[model samples]
Target: MVTLRIATFNLENFDEVPPNVRPSLAERVAVMRPQIERLQADVLCLQEVHGQERPGQPRALLALAELLAGTKQAAANVVTTSGPNGEVFDQRNLVLVTSLPVMARAQLLNTLVAAPMYQILTANPPAPQPMPILLERPILHVELDLQGVPLHVIVVHLKSKLPTNIPGQKVDDFTWRSADAVAEGAFISSMKRMSQAVEVRRLVDSILDQDPAGRIVVAGDFNATSDEVPLVAIRGDVEETGNGALAGRVLVPVENTIPEPARYSLFHHGKGQMLDHILVTRNMLAHYRGSEIHNEVLHDESGAFATDVKYPESDHAPVVATFEFA
Candidate 1:
């Protein structure tokens, strides 16, 4: 049997910004290189990667691959999809593999999904206005050959839960920001994430429709916790029949092996939260050996952010899952 390690990490906007403006590429690499080396993942899915806006310009992803040179976990093969152009900030999802051979690669972006009624009509308009549904980040899909075993991988970064309030719009008058403004904003954000999750599930279903026993892995910074609506939608609730047969194919979150208090990936205002996850289909779960959340790498000896003489590595932690193949 062959064991493969797959990991997902959010690089926290790895871009080549002007020096002193933000942490430069060199600074990020300085802190991230060692952490990635420790992961030693055969297949790595990355989010918040800054892609080059120009069509033909040099890509930071390639440069990151170069930085892994001479490391045990060097990504000799890498794949990435471009984001929308002419934006002040451009971010993308990327996949890097050291051994697995990619069989196919595709990306989902700007795809439309059904919008909730509340989003379409503030208070029942003459006609429901069309609301654009765009993915916060393109889902990076890659099919890899792990010693002849086809493994389907989908990398995603769901919409963040930030308040969506427009300027000059009174809190009481805004549809998304009324008496319960905070709750309303959260509902809107969750709706966006739920739409994205639905799309991911559709992609999973597409693969399953072709092969019921397909091995699939979906990993990334979901930005939502395990019990949240978004995750609930992606990892459908389990249902069983009298004969003990699963109702349908449902993804399962890899068990959190890390000790209780330390399982979190990010800390905000002293509250630690597990925003990153690695989930696998039932077929893949049969081969799942174990999983790990590399939260330790995000901190230093002093238990604070890993300061590399300049800046912190990343605000998020990396999650790794190991699976055995016969």
Candidate 2:
């Protein structure tokens, strides 16, 4: 049997911004590179990776390249989600790097489900008609040849818990003028996040419908905990479906196997949260060995007092899982 390691990390706002403006690329690399090295992953799924633009050239992931400069993944096959123009966005691009042979790849954006339309209840004038709720990012699906086995890997970076903006409700970035507006904004954000989760669940169903025994693995920064709505939507537990026959279609979170004390991948206001995840189909879970959350150096990014803090490393910790294939 051969073992394959897969890892997911959210390099929080990873970019080549000016050093004086934010942490320089080299500074981030100095700290992040070691984390990448520790993962030793055969397949790496990355979120919040910014694309860089150069004169007369399409956008490039310069920052990511620098981070993997001397690592084994430096020469791996890299794939990223792109916009309608076939170019990666300037910020928060989903990336997948793997040494295995790639069979096929696709991106999902309102492909399975149509975009929902809703009227803004908190707009200033409240006179406009309903508008389409567009997804901020696409779900990346890649088919890889892991040795001789066909493996389906879906990478996602779902919407954050931050409230969606209302036309005239915000007093500032972090403050809202009206509590009602804040509630509406948060409702809109939850709608968007749950919609994205529905789309992902539909994609998973499509794969399972075509190949029931598909070796599937979904990994990324879900921005939600295991018990949250987004996860519950994607997991499709048999209990929720009330159909035992659908048990084979369920997806299990690998982090559940890890000790609760060491299960978290991020710290917010002194509370540990498992926002990053690696979920696999039961067929693949049979071969699962163990998992790890490299969060020893994690520091709280949110607190009561506001203070400018610059961390060279990413706020999120990397999560990895290993599986052996016959």
All candidates: TM-score: 0.81, 0.97
Top model number, lDDT: 2
After superposition, candidate 1 runs with Cα above 4 Å error:
53-63, 72-75, 83-89, 96-98, 110-130, 165-184, 239-244, 297-310
Q: Give one digit per residue, the lDDT tens place, for model 1 in 214-289.
A: 8888899899888777787787656422333443568888855567787787766567788898888877767888
Candidate 2 per-residue lDDT, tens place, 132-157, comes to 88888889999999777789999999
Number of colliding residue pairs in each model: 0, 0
- Which residue pairs clash within candidate 2? none
lDDT of 1 at 257: 58
Tell me the deviation in Å of residue 88 in model 1: 14
C-alpha lDDT score of every prediction, in listed order? 0.71, 0.90
RMSD from true fold, candidate 2:
1.4
